[model samples]
Target: MTRSCVVSVGLLLLAVSTLTYGQGLLVVTDPDQVVRLPRPILIWPPDRPVVRPEPPAAYKIKQLEVNARLLDQVAQVQVSQSFTNTGSRQLEVAFLFPLPYDGAIDSMTLLVDGKEYPARLLKSDEARKLYEQIVRKNQDPALLEWMGTGLFKTSVFPVPAGETRTVSLRYSQLCRQHDGLTDFLFPLSTAKYTSHAVDEVSFRVTIESAQEIKNVYSPSHSVEIKRPDDNHATVTYKTKNEVPTEDFRLFYDVGKGKVGTRVLSYRPDEDDEGYFLLLAGPKIESKDNEHQKKTVMFVVDRSGSMTGEKIEQARGALKFVLNNLREGNLFNIVAYDSEVESFRPELQKFNEETRKAALGFVEGIYAGGSTNINAALRTALAQLQDSKRPSYVLFLTDGLPTVGETKEMQIVDNAKEANDVRARIFAFGVGYDVNSRLLDKLAREGFGQSQYVRPNEDIEDSVSRLYRRIESPVMTDVTIEFAFDEKHEELGKPVSRVYPKGSFDLFAGEQLVVVGRYKKAGPVKVTVRGSVAGEEQKLDFPAKLARHSEDETAGFIEKLWAVRRIGEILDELDLKGKNEELIEELVKLSTRHGILTPYTSFLADEDTSIRDTASNLRRADRRLSALAEPSGAGGF
Candidate 1:
């Protein structure tokens, strides 16, 4: 008797596996022997061994290639697989393919070595019976995952020893849509079927829409996306010599407005709240006049500790920013040591002459004197007089404050007092000598982020990368409000615990993803307000909160929300003093989600009881306090 390979395809689930291995196996079966016997020979007879005694070199997957074309809500997918047989004996194999549970497939075709193969489709009841028979005979629970799906069975085929066979399957179906975004998923979790790693795996998807595409994102894998135009995009991912652990998923939205918004929600139980993800982005292509003018102040440190290569790199980074400023943007430079100096007393228009003089000023800056972070921030904030425009302070430092007003809290307070225009302060700590907690607080209060450069990294590269993201700001001081419909006003607050706690700016060619929780399921109105070119602009979008979702495809939203919420709690514990409530929540979330942090890794122990909240809190406190502060480029 020969082993058989079963390929199951259905809504949100696709798998290829051998009868011996269960979920994702590809093997060979003798159809004549299976039909002539009272019981199918491929059903794992009682006399045969359940598990293979050794690695099955007879069958192996060499390469898997997936290509999909998504047009609006419809997707055309093609999967090609190559199988190599290394056994000494010739084997006959029958191929079985499954269709989606909904049976919404418009068309499907199967090919073997470019020759068409006839296939018979089995209904759900028949497929379920066959799946259960195999599971009961083999005592393999993994096969149960595909029991409810339909099946397509093909005739027998022969594979000689030391040869390869190629199979291709193509189908088209209407994709699932939530809010304004379209979702596409492909199953690639093949790590358990075979002992040897797959040689190669590649996935390419092309998306085309009638409306302009705004956001294209994949939370499972890091993918490279190319947008040829506003309406077309290509996403590609490839790997070599490895087995995949997760499926491939993608979400994208299309709209005609200057800025597009999308929301996705998932709830596991009817009595509990739901998790939601909000995506927003500006148009990919915008005219020069559509760009919002911004005011930029570069605050650099020239302390004596930065005399050699550090000072040179800082100077080069300043030049990069000066050269990239837009024509109408407002700009100024402030360099500080023990005494603070300015390129100009006030902000100046970014014209050719002003840019030239700014370049000269940057070149003249050299390292000397002590560090005065307090005075540097104050001087830079004073120049941001235009409250209508988006303002930023690129504060760079490489050492602890040693000059006047060296207290960390005092400097933070001083900067907050002087920032009357609400200018965002992006702190760049070049090395480890600086206090990370202080920088984090500054950025948090200033509505910006903190970045650190390692000893081996280039300062110019780090600064330039950040500059590109903010160069074409389309909106600033962004805020989102979610409201219930008239009938659902009793729900009270529609959403809570949104990450990125304060207002954020939106830039062209960049997408912002906000995650939160919803109190009830109903129709809701989402309003986005931001300042555009010194004027307030508002955009409204209507969305729905899901009543309940058992769909595995929607499961990512819950995990993503949990990951982000855990991060926020960790950051709070790092900055503020330890709190028992925060620690308890952290342990619970970590244990439930299987998220392992340095302080919560003990949850992996079998004896660790998640219900013992008090013990877990004490453990977290002891672990966190015992860990010494990081010395190098490490920071929260």
Candidate 2:
């Protein structure tokens, strides 16, 4: 508890700092200083308190090409950008590359007229001082605040007028997984930082997995996916002379086992601490598993506040769940306002006849009256008394409890007491008026998750996405156990941390990735234990551990572990409120790993913190300059 609190405190502090420094750099220009550039050479958004000084010379991106390969769950990416001096005269440019959190740069090269220039990496602390020097000289505090974020900065390079320079960066990242899907995100929405769009931008990704590749989907951009077989797929995305407005996001599924699992480890050297990523999921076949049955209770709030589009969307969502209901599954819907109404008195078997009747009940649901969340949840929980089968409660609300036991905690407590069976409660909050904290608490206590839908988002989509994953759960109370033997003394303390912490139910077509640190690497034994159809079932698999490589193939594992660990800690911080120790540790983790959190953002409100940061940056920059100068000279 002490350790956890300290970590949380650190994160809160980091969040506060991030917000404060995020105000942006106020660029200042000195008529005498030719060394200073008015605008950032990189494409990051201007820091707050933004100052735009017309540059003596202008630069524009000509083209960009991104090539990526996914070997297992890790991705090796190369980004090359072409920049031309669009303005008159020769200009010295400070090239900047915004790096993904936890991403490590392997190599960088600058081609000025096809001749390579020298480049070096700077740690965050050193980079922070560099920004301070620029901000102090420019009188732009905004520049200093966000300057220290994970970045790859190259030395000043000369770009001749009408000449183009090509910059190529190579790096690697560990892709994260959720519910059997691995997502790769590229931060390509930099056109907003520039005045116009680039001429051409293209990206290609080739994925190879030990297990068969199942699905390849990209939601951000139009993409063409080619799959020669289940084990390999290639995706290509391109745009011609268009503004880059959104980031590129791709999600894919891998493996074919009923429960797909893979173990990846990374150690820096032959004898050092390492990290591991554990990916597991049920098979992605379209057919539902017949070995298990489920009882679903949908408790939806139809308060007067949900009279318009919200209620209609809710009805459509209910209809979707009914249509997707699996055979032999038991289901019911309970709609509540000040008064409670159930579609059926008891759980009804899912069939064509009952499905039609449920749709009728959904259509008859008219929004009116105040909210009675406590009573509504109680009524739904009462129907989930059967422990012989897996059960779930999909709760939706658009408002807080307004009538009958309005206290949020009391309502959650009462629902907990009513639910004797270990049923998962998936809660959804519609629009901003809903109490997110209450829903989160309810879901957490009920061994489930809480989702919030903004006013602009469709409720039907959010509910349907979740329903599809839970529609066919193959295992309940799922637990993973790792064993080590004397031959593999390097395996260390097997599992350091799991995001969800304890045992969780596993649904078909869904995957879970567990990230943690390990002391050594070698072969290890892993066992997955879960309850299937109320019977205990277990499977054993063999996995091998590895060390980190300079090629970046396995280097991202440590950073991936840090990301998941930080997310888990942030979730805890949200539930437990502010703790000094936790905030302190969070800051340490964020600073070391370059992970950004809401509490530690670059935007700011307080003046004292900014002043202190600026002062420190100035001192550090002076010291750094002194160290770089010749022994005879005071500074460069």
Candidate 3:
């Protein structure tokens, strides 16, 4: 028997995009929206799997179910979907899933004809090449983006003329926090991209926290919430036969204090080293602890390039910050281009009269001259010499240094020296042309973080969102230490790097998640230390290390650790030009677990396959290790 097959590359894209990070089953969408597996037209005998030639009039999504659990800030999600075959022919197909940014797919299962099949993970380059070949042969622009992103692949055979096949995927990621809230997003807009209306879509999320849960809200979808107690809540959403144009998004805040400490760990094998994630923060203090007063300074860059909407947005953001300053808090604004100007001669207390005057001052600023980033930072830092108060400098810039201290590194170093008062420098890069390395280095040196906004995003929104998190400082100069005994010393340092990568101030209603490695696993105690209102405070949390490799609760720890670690590598690459060692490490980590970083994507070029590159690297690494070892006869 002979048979011919032609699969729809569009349908394959629907499958891939559905795996985006979040807690729920992603419905498949149109081909143009996401990169997808190549459609292969095959001619073979009847026994082999074959694609159908005719396109279905309507490709309807039958069902979607999402189950998610949060252990502190880490989310573990399971997604299950039923994609029906409406056409009247026995067809063979493979459903593909693209990994969400900074997320790792742990496992996948496919069910067909009452049997289950496991899925496979492919290297980015290998996957990209496969899709590219299909795109070239079939002229499918839809598969282009799939080139570098890691993916999960599963196959189903013999659809039997009107049957449905199910795919289930389990994955996890570290939820990002802004201000006091953690945001969770699920890609659920695929139904709108499909040919037909989705029959049903549903989502359920179970939140568990040691602290009291507050303000569980969804901005993207209307949801019903059920709270059995302060520490637990369940949220659900469902709809029938409708188009979904937006992804599902939810935000929730957990109260601070004793309830804020949590431990999440993962180990794939007992023989292998394990990884751990720790989150700790202080609760809202009473009058006795007294929240510390904060001093905030905004350094705005109104260079010639920001003459249009960019400068207006920056001014709007400054106004928003002034209006929201806490009472008794000290604040100031500095607008600079070729020359620097200040709202007041010095920082002033936040009050109605000053805020009103500040708003007026912001409106008078206009974009002109060249960018003087060095002097701008110096002027802002000059007023923040008070060590007793927690100070923050929100530096906003849209272009590179053009007027004074034109060198990027010199400006970063100067900024570091001027920040002697320990003001956290949260940098905002408004456009693509700004030097990202300078911003990143500045933030790292000043004990803060850097954020980037594209041309389409609103700078005001980004600035306002960041202000909320730092609005109410409860703890400052936070440090974490793990209790190690004589028995634990043999295992070496258990922690390699904590996410955020340095000491930070902890605000009220906020939690910190730290990732690290351990040489050995056993019972352990962790301590969090910080200063509140210029007084030292300490808290301890009890956590027992997972003894074996199959600790279900900690399965996602390793992936989250890799995400942060890869981020560090990227930072280094940005700061100190690219290197072979860094690129090799990035490619290896990405291929092993599908972490999609810009470096990994760049390394996955058309000239060579990522998997082959990784394999060659491993062989070379082994050879180097062997050469470095000392011979018994020659060793002293």
Candidate 4:
């Protein structure tokens, strides 16, 4: 027999619940407030067939909207969700909401179709018993993820089949802060419980602070961020007909300084080493005279292979850089083929007249001879004469070195010798024909980064986008050091294995995140040093490493550190050739952190046992054998 019944939950209130990470069953919000509920399910007969039973009815979410306003560390959030029952039978539904393991809400309100509902709040123990009952009867373990948290329960009312329901939830909470950064997180992983993909989803958060906000970043999802002023900013993420796989997390820091730095640390176990993330950025507002002066050299490859559309895009990229050069900046261009040629004999000061002349020079250039990467790099690096001025070599090429000094290591050594002023060389490999290993080596040894452009991609867009990010150089040759108290010095180095490995540059409107490991927990002094124009500048801040394991909110720090460390190891394997030690470390990290890479993807198989070290090593060995050939573009 088929049953028909509809249960409408009245107002329910939950208090002192610990908020943690789990699959969000149902989240409803209005234009300005947010509320979340665990997925509701229909109660089936106990005697139903075990194998061929009919599928249980489920509600399909049509739309979801979340809006929040954060002032200082307090957040007011609103959520609205519209859903419809997909089955013909009317079913009684019970809604449950899971809170964070360490989170609490100050106040909350719920509404259905503009009418308030009166609901009862359950204490943690009572909530646990109710969750246990549901799990025992339904033979489902999903609710076990939120067993420890308190829940809100309500009396069921009648709702006709095929009718849509709009529910809204509003709440206020205090946000957590680590070091100087404030974190905001929302649970959006909803695909597991819903009947169909959410038709629409939108999230908007506005942050206001009394102090100037320095760094605002989201590592989980790609979001659009706008800073109306130093103290106020808005972050937004929207999607259509898609199910979100991960929760939304954002970290922002506020302070006043020419350069601001913040640190986030996570120690899962006190006995094990902890991971740390350091964020540093320049002030948003600076006077025109305060802007640091720098030198830029664009090295373009004009070979026979770049004769068609490639050459035109290269010319356009040069024009973009030339047009964006600042008043006090010094700039030049080096175009190369079988031989090297320069726009000027020396670096010229950026001015209207020089820019116009340079544009004309770019127009007259044509592609004909073979690629001489060695001569081009040397000529460009030699032009950087002022050590005090921040210098850059924007090297572009589309083919392997066929002319002078074609050997990869020798070319790298020649450029290193010529770069007397220590200019940063950013290498752009234009197409598959380019030797990615050579470009990567040149950039790595020259203290810059290598970027690859596929045949179908636009070289102009790739170069112009990067130029925009580093347009306003604030500091050059940046370095960071962590120091502990004299008593703690006996514990050995407090921090190690910092990524970016060595010195780097800082730009205005950009935030630099550095990840590493910390051996001890205590008060530590963080000192950041860099060159501003021609003078040395140093700034220091006091921070603390955690002595015990923090809550899951700080968990992302460890995962992010693992990701970067893995990247560095992979790069080493690609550039320096594979070593057993690096390979073993890669497999260990990937399996432990659940970070699957191309070489460690076997861990995803159900048959793969994470505890079997021998089997994993054998699998990794098999995968490594397939990667003997160097990657065609940049990295494997």
Candidate 5:
């Protein structure tokens, strides 16, 4: 049968949300509270899978910057773009952009060459989600997936063929969470949740046009906004003026280290790693043994999903990791399909000859049959049990638990229980096909780490990054213990992490910031402790926690806060059902905070959504890990 389909609006919202990245609660009682600008958007999936013979991306990566505070459940991104005009003759330009479900669209304007043109959101999501969601009228799942393809929001501007016209955009947004990376999206604001916080959100903008014509200039818009020209603009928003708490002294949240930037290739950035992991999440540290011997179980999935170059890459990566194994380290291999096969019935003794022989077996391995992940896990556990050495299971796969009695949740519980046995599990996800959440849980329970490798990208870089973390434990088992000095600032829930900020996908430099108010000051210090292998280490760092730091770190702090708010909004959308007003507010906040929210692209009137794009992407990605269909394949 032909696959299920839907239009996408949330995707377009990615572009539109940036408009209000610097404004606040200026509730518009009237329609023209601000000019209704034309909607702008990209027609391609930004994270589409990379096939062999890599071709140029259809929608060029004009500019992409995304900073997320996973604990905060909020994400902010800036996308700069340019489009080519292939018209035969001078033709008018128009655009149709979709808003995200939990976001809003504002600061809509069009610029040709350098001249500014008025734009408007003339469409709505009236019909799109009627098919994808239950409450069609009240909610717009289109906002979650919509990317306006046929719709044009720009004032019809004439341009010549074989020419390139430059169009520039500046906007902001706030969004909620969604379920399943596939078409299945869960809103976090399902029960009863609400938040009102905004922070400094900005990114430098530039554009190139193929069809050149018309003058350019930046027209004044909202907030502390300024536009130097159509191709460039800057906006900044104030963070929460009054923090919520009054118990302890609250400070802006930054990755648990000095706020700074650096150029590096071998390490993971505190920012890139996400605040949740370094903060409330489990601490990571690898073991080393100059004397004590340990066993490692390499769990490989030779299912059909691992077919093609992807499998080859996995095999190569696996081999590369295997090569690093030191002498006296016992190891075993579990290759699973519909059933299970072992590298040897039991853990193999580590030595030069055996290692080489195992590598040979890995090279000869081929992909076929269905998936049996649980059985593989069980067998690997058995090998570790049968051997009397500290064991580490490197579980790798690209699909869901398709062929086993062990349910996904059960697998998670069992993995956690297995950890108590002193065996650690390090999980690696390949592309969008693997169950990331499950992998995340497995790693946490096993006291290990989870790393994801996207296709066509540099797998070596990803693998190397994980290796660095394993080797170094700047701080481990880190639990932030800070007493409020005076409860001056209601320091919102903070995400603590210590590492280089560059790791954050957010290209702009990372500065730690707090989202609360200040009342008093006192000595502040954070204590972190964890195991580096089987041994324990501890550190206490003197910190300058503050109610407010108007400088750079505040931006980083608030971005982190916004992520939390977005999570709540997504909860509302996915669980409680649609509440446009709440979503709109979130969209407005995300817009101001430089975060991506669904409200920006989701339209309540049109069924238009980017689901098609992501869905098509899902189908195209035969390697995707998602199983329950409607959304084929998985994610990238």
Candidate 6:
């Protein structure tokens, strides 16, 4: 208990420092004015909407190629593109890329109009997650996708006539701190025409960004050299000797307040990490697209660890999902501590009475025993599989799995085997004590997603989201069939990358981009099969196949999944028996991509405790830097 207060104080102090530094940086740039560019749009063919979103319909893609290489931990992306002005009007094209919390421009080489320009890096805006969330809660998802966000920005490209405009952008970055999780958010500062998805390659991370930027993890080496003007020479490292994982965000703005947004997931064809770009002043709104045969089972971990607001918050979330349950939709409730209890082991039809009853059950839930996530999942799954509808298993927990299947891997394998077309498990890792990796893997393997619920987070918001995903299934039986023959196929390819999506991972947000190479020009068909309600439906999609070289095949999709999976793999280094080559290569790719991998964990945050009195001696240097010094006093 005593240790808790100290840790909380430290987190508070760290958060304050980050906000201070963030504000200080934003203070330098005027919010109302700055050089702005808008993101280029994609021209997607007309087709029935898949469970995922359609790619941007503005940028007519010509030819895009990406190359990736890695150094220790930093990953670099080298993008080559050919874009044509497919429309009549003069178009300004830009690419908006997400930036991690702590990152900087290592180097930028741009070829614009046959002239090269080196970009000066500056953090133009900083915002609290609080404000972002509030706006998101009220904003339209489509507007956010097309407009702009806090970190989202656009690159400038002015094209007229039907001529093909070729652009080469080389951006590299180093990082300072590390956060366990980072959703790179690229904000749009202006508006412009749509562009193409050229190539995006990644390498490895040399350092982390969080360490240099905010620092809640540990101390990192940072270099700052003031130049002639406001620009400064910057290089930050999570360790003494290592490159840094710094992200580059590109933005294109429609100067007169016309901007666009794209809220999507990485490797949209598959379920990768979520990626989004926001450009407008409007807010984002949550949605729940009702689907057929939906059942939501909330398995709550009411352990003593969740005594105060946590329990109350959980109750609110429980009530929210229950209230949202549509008529005739099936649902159940389960609360567990050391033992497990379900409101109904079988699916119960949703009605006014049923919702009231479920709320009563939630009210009766009180913190009691040790966390038994295994039992909770099993019980919830059993309840979820009751009906053939797309059943959602929402598990919330704050402690390690005990009682049943304590081993995280064991639980994951069991849950993976347990998942059927009817059931998808969504895990919520609540508080610091929960084994997030275990829950995360469970959700991934079970066809849902994982989310972290900090102690301060409201349970109502999270659970309501679960209910929404439980209902929306834009297009089911999502399957991808590569028309290419055996040569181009990897040793083992994923048969299909389909899953039920929710509000944050919205169906309309994720872009379904299926990429594969074929040997011959013969046509191929992709057959998909899934149930809309309880009835099975299948569709065959035909498209022309092109042969892409192995080199070309390893582009954005390759690097995006690699960077994402490599981060997960690094987190489980203790498992052992993994390929050293893949790890090493992944490290290099991450470095080039400005992505943090296992080798780059140190760059996320600083570990210094601001609340510890014993660390009073450590404040000497920070104190000096905190106060604004007179310009003439420092050897001027």
Give the best candidate by lDDT: 3
TM-score of 1: 0.53
For residue 553, model 1's alpha carbon misses the true position, in angstroms, by 3.2
| Model 5 lDDT at residue 55 | 20
Task: Residues 1-636, candidate 2: write the lDDT tens digits.
Answer: 000000000000011011100011113333122221111122223344635534445556677788988876678788777767666765444434444334544444556555543222232344345434544453211111122323333322344678776666566666545544677877565433443666888989999977778889988899999999888999999897776766677888764455556887776555555677788764433344454788999999988999999999999999999998878889999999999999998899999999999999999999999999998888888888688788899999987789999876677778879989878999997875666557767886788877767566699999998887787667788887777776755645565665456677877555666667665556678888888766788877888777444554665676566665665565567546788787666655544443444333221111213233233221223433433432200110
As a whole number from 0 to 100, the lDDT of residue 158 in candidate 6 is 41
**Per-residue accuracy of model 4 over 487-531 as CA lDDT, tens digit each:** 777777789988767888766555666778998898898888887
Candidate 1 achieves a global lDDT of 0.63
As for model 2, its CA RMSD to the true structure in angstroms is 11.1
Best candidate, TM-score: 3
> What would the per-residue lDDT of candidate 6 be over residues 1-636, giving only the tens digit for each residue?
000000000000001001001001101111223322111112222333445532221233344333322221223544444555544554434333333212222223334344433322111111122223423443200000111110232333344546454443333322111111112112111111112122222222222221122211212223222223221112211221111222222111112221122111222222222221111111122234434656677788898888988888888888777777788788888899888898976879999888888888888999978877777777667544543456677888877876766876777766655554446677776765666557656765676666656454566686675465445654444443434345544433322322122211223222233322222333344444444444555545444322332232223333343334454455345344467776665544443333333332111001112232122211223322321232100000
Instruction: State TM-scores per candidate.
Output: 0.53, 0.61, 0.64, 0.54, 0.47, 0.46
Off by over 4 Å in 1: 1-260, 282-285, 324-329, 349-356, 399-414, 431-441, 452-458, 563-578, 581-599, 603-636
Give residue 573's error in model 3 in angstroms: 2.0
Model 4: lDDT to the true structure: 0.62
Determine which window of 10 residues in candidate 5 has minimal summed lDDT: 184-193
lDDT agreement with native, every candidate: 0.63, 0.63, 0.64, 0.62, 0.40, 0.41
Model 5 residue runs over 4 Å out of place are 1-77, 84-295, 308-313, 327-330, 344-364, 378-392, 398-402, 405-426, 429-476, 484-521, 532-534, 551-553, 564-594, 597-636
Task: Give the total clashing residue pairs for model 3.
Answer: 5
Model 6 compared with the native: what TM-score?
A: 0.46
RMSD of each: 18.3, 11.1, 11.5, 17.1, 18.3, 22.9
lDDT of 1 by residue, 268-302 (tens): 77877788888666453545677778888999999
Candidate 5 positional error at 593, Å: 5.1
Model 6 — which ten-residue stretch has the worst lDDT? 4-13
